[model samples]
Target: MRLWAASVAICMAQAAHACETALLLTIDVSNSIDVAEYRLQVDGLADALLDAEITDVIVQGQSALAVVQWSGVDRQELSIPWTQLRSRTDVQTFAAQARAMPRAFVLSDTAPAEALDFALRQFADAPACDRRVIDVSGDGTPNSGSDPRPMVRAAERAGVTVNGIAIESMGLAITNFYRREIITRDGFVITARQHRDYPRAIREKLLRELSRILG
Candidate 1:
């Protein structure tokens, strides 16, 4: 009887920790991203998390989040560890942490395939959630490492969705590349007119991801 009671408690604990979504945000910080552009990406993401609608969804759904900075084949860092947004305070704390984080890599080449591979490993450590998503934000296509399409397929096989946010500083070329090679079939892409517009794009993307609204 004691063993059965302990088993029930363990299951209850697991249920309580489950979240609506586990989102892994992978940002590019390759050589092309200047210091100012890097700041924009980091600060923009911080501000997006503070958006009213986004905050509300996060708090209500208790979504898990992590941020990764990726560049060349071996340059990928988990800037923000797995955190659960279960309340207003939790959201605020995450925003503050994001804003204060230092750039993980610079002077590195673009490697989207390696980035995706790294992000997939991150999911293994995340809290259990109903949906798992990888949000890749970058301004350029891969110029180094393996092809990203296979990684996208691997994500699909893992039942993980891969979304893209293309920073269109160099025009729609990068956006087109993302649509063709990065995002999964069930996922979509958001285009930021430039680095400065990342905050708005990220907010909208978060809304759609958390709410499951394709539009």
Candidate 2:
């Protein structure tokens, strides 16, 4: 009985280590976002994770995820630590944590460059996985900090894919900027027609990111 238990524990430990992807979700909490908008972003993310298709992919792939709330140069908080989604319970727990998480910043400028830099550093502590991705969602382009192009290049060189979700509340300016300067060569961008459409866009993005067929 003792030998059987030991064997099972070893197999479980090995399975836990076999993650297919490490995904870091970076959300913008700049001053441009009103309180209502912030709530939408937060709730939308939680809802996206709960979507049936998204949850299915997460469980099947054993994807590890983390969330960062980013704004100004000095404002980037790890809202949720890395959590592996290997089962229904794990997905439910992650969604609950995301829904309950508080906003990290309220009155800061948009600084995509600094946010990207901070996100890159996060991968150092990520679990071993087949892919590393940073999914940055923002409603504005960079208004402060260094240029993000170089950092985007650096991320690509480090074998990390940086994708983007552009909230088009202010028009396509942010979306164009993300396409040209933010997303990596192999990464794709999702466009939210407005802040209200964030949940749908996030669901699609998560599905693509977590699915083996699309990934």
Candidate 3:
């Protein structure tokens, strides 16, 4: 019985060491996010990915990340492919690559629900990740395309956690709407208190989320 207990302990240790987690990050590039704001948010996200503290928890080849930019309607474009965030160097490389990605398309209206749908499809076939998450950022409520309710429900069903980073320089009322209508359990929302503080808010929020997800 003693030998059996030791064997089980070893197996559990190995299993824990071999665990890998996958996470997806989505940014809004819709019209509401003006040109200057767009650059801030995009580059802020890139910086967050590079932060040492955020990458410290990645277990070698066992952790991965992917990024996508979403615009009006269902236009979700991949910014970076899934990559093993093994070391600080890997984090730097990934952030550099993301920073190189352009705004790609102009914005029209907010369609967060569509972004969720596209993210679901993009990540559905990813290798069996230990913990899967969809980190999304947006400024306004849904104004175009499909409704967000069904897709949000589907994401929850698939064991994917949905976190929101709502830019709220506009007001608290809109942010309140997002908190209620969207965002999932075990998830969080970070706000850009003022339009000028968007970059800082996004970077801080993303780094926090990365830490939580990897932990």
- Per-residue lDDT for 1-215 in model 1, tens only? 99999999999887766699999999899999999998898888889899888999998788999999999999999999999988989999999999999998878999999999999999989998999999999999788999999999999999999998999976699889999999998999999999889988988899999997642
Residues 54-173, candidate 2: write the lDDT tens digits: 888888889999999999999999989988888988999999999889888888999999999999999889989999999999998888888999999999999999888999976688
TM-score order, best first, reads 1, 2, 3
What is the TM-score (0 to 1) of candidate 1?
Answer: 0.92
Residue 56, candidate 3: Cα error in Å is 1.2
Q: What are the candidates' C-alpha RMSDs?
A: 2.7, 2.9, 3.8
Give me the overall lDDT of model 3.
0.74
TM-score of each: 0.92, 0.92, 0.84
Off by over 4 Å in 1: 1-17
Question: What range of 10 consecutive residues in model 3 has the weakest lDDT sum?
Answer: 206-215
- Local accuracy of candidate 3 as per-residue lDDT tens digits, 1-215: 99999999999887655536677888888887788887787678777666555666654535678888887775778878777666677788888887778886684777888888888887755656667888788878888887777877888798788877777865675567667766776677777775666667766765666566422
Best-to-worst ranking by lDDT? 1, 2, 3
